[model samples]
Target: MNATQRTNERPGIEKNRIIRIENGKKAYLPLLLLADEQEDMIDRYLERGEMFVLEDGDRALAGVVVSDEGDGVLEIKNLAVIPAHQKKGLGRRMIGFIADRYRDRFHTLLVGTGDSPMTVPFYEKCGFARSHVVKDFFLDNYDHPIIEDGVRLRDMIYFKKSI
Candidate 1:
């Protein structure tokens, strides 16, 4: 599938905008939940972190949340693209946007995701390298067992990319 890249101009597509949502971000809970799953778990970070929505024309295609982790580190707490919009490079574009948007303010961009066949490779493909893993992160943080791509996720794999 062909993906869109950021550039000065494009034809036949509405201008895409990434907007930082400062208040009432809870309205995108359904979209956010696609990434984090648990509402209470999301609540732990939602209020304190910053949220952004990717909008094209009148459609909101994806959402991401980030938080300052201090020490020149910025963490991608959650990222989710609507099911219908997945695999269209929107997610990667959001990542690239985040990188450019924060390159001056942060040294490293980190994301924690499940160790599943479906996820780790995607992050690696997005220029992120395996940094570390937190054992039992899913089991310890979530109230229920998490599984993806037919595999049970027991650890949280952390990936990092230097800006």
Candidate 2:
């Protein structure tokens, strides 16, 4: 589908809808940064990845970027919900949308995130189980230390769920 094409799938909400952003995905960088903090890191996959945004009218409430990682694996490159709309199930809704949309095409949904109190529990709540860890991923990759919820992020904790 083109950039303007929107999916009819709704996450149990009438006004909010998910749309595939085929072009100009960087326009939502602010939202994307909420999940993946560094721009350079995002650039690694943003262009090749498929982006989806949850919108309430013209305002975007959340966004997710997914990439085909071969071997029937779809990795969530990034996912973020606006602070005002977070903790209100928008993130979960976005995940549900992705899982449902890719169920037939992919067998597993994967995500790598910092081992922060703020994120680990969230992914667990979304039905993801701890898979593996990439040692010192944040320290080795990011330009500087990434701190979340007063804890310095070190390893990249990977999570997976069967689609």
Candidate 3:
């Protein structure tokens, strides 16, 4: 089936639906980049992974990409909610949806994000504990420096939650 064809498989369950995208990762680029700023960095995992979009009726509110990172682990490569829909419990719901959907397939769910005042707390609140940190990750990986909440992002902080 095409990417848009299988969107509303469960119509009566809830208005907020999470649809898995098997192709066309680029179509959700604008939202994806909100979570991970660099386009080229996203390219490394976008097509090789699976994508999901959270939609409320006809409106797309958030998107996420997860990839099998080997050793029975699934990593969330990117997750972003539309600015207008932020802080509405949509992101936590999406994370819960992904965890439930992949629990039987993977032992754990991992998400790597930058060390930022704005992002780290949110992930921690989502039940993810800090597993490790990659020093100078953003400075070394991306072509340009990344800053969030007025602080320069220099480390890649990894968080994990067992499913």
Candidate 4:
């Protein structure tokens, strides 16, 4: 893939890097940049073939993670904003778009993330609240040491929202 073509996937004004996922290879490049553990979930989602992507110009800004969690609960599997794009409200917009997918079908949406001081408020701002805490979140899920800004990681507080 040409660097310019690959990077320029986001359309229109060059800030909306949006792409509808048709296959694993297409989603991999964008997801790899967004996710901390890379695109490990690509194959499983590809098997079901229910994935999509959003980007800013040539840069992949964010991706919404939707997965079947049984009984009409769609889990927001892994929404990641590349480090460069963290402070922007793009994460919120992408999340709203993802949550809108269930509409009236799904009863609730579940998301789990680190329990550190930083993440709890971010989720709260996203309209999610503390439902429960899971021990050793990073150790269980991540492939490598998940040191964020030199702090050792473990456990996660799960949040849920009804729509």
Q: Which candidate is the best by lDDT?
A: 2
**lDDT per residue, candidate 4, 45-102, as tens digits?**
5445345567655566677657777897777766667767787887787778767767
Write model 1 residue lDDT over 1-163, tens digit each, in one string: 3344545345665667888899898989999999989999899889988889998765689999989999999999989999999988989998998999989999999999998877777798899999998999988888888879888788898999999
How well does candidate 4 match the true structure in TM-score terms?
0.74
> What 10-residue stretch in candidate 3 is worst by lDDT?
7-16
> Which residue pairs in candidate 1 have backbone atoms (N, alpha carbon, C) closer than 3 angstroms, thus clashing?
none
**How high a TM-score does candidate 1 get?**
0.89
lDDT at position 21, candidate 2: 99
Task: Please provide TM-scores, in order, for all candidate models, with all chains considered together.
Answer: 0.89, 0.90, 0.89, 0.74
Candidate 4 ranges with C-alpha deviation above 4 Å: 1-18, 25-33, 38-49
Q: Which stretch of 10 consecutive residues in model 1 shows the poorest summed lDDT?
A: 1-10
Candidate 2 root-mean-square deviation in Å: 6.9
Off by over 4 Å in 2: 1-14
Model 3 vs. true fold: TM: 0.89
Task: Name the 10 consecutive residues with the lowest summed lDDT in model 2.
Answer: 2-11
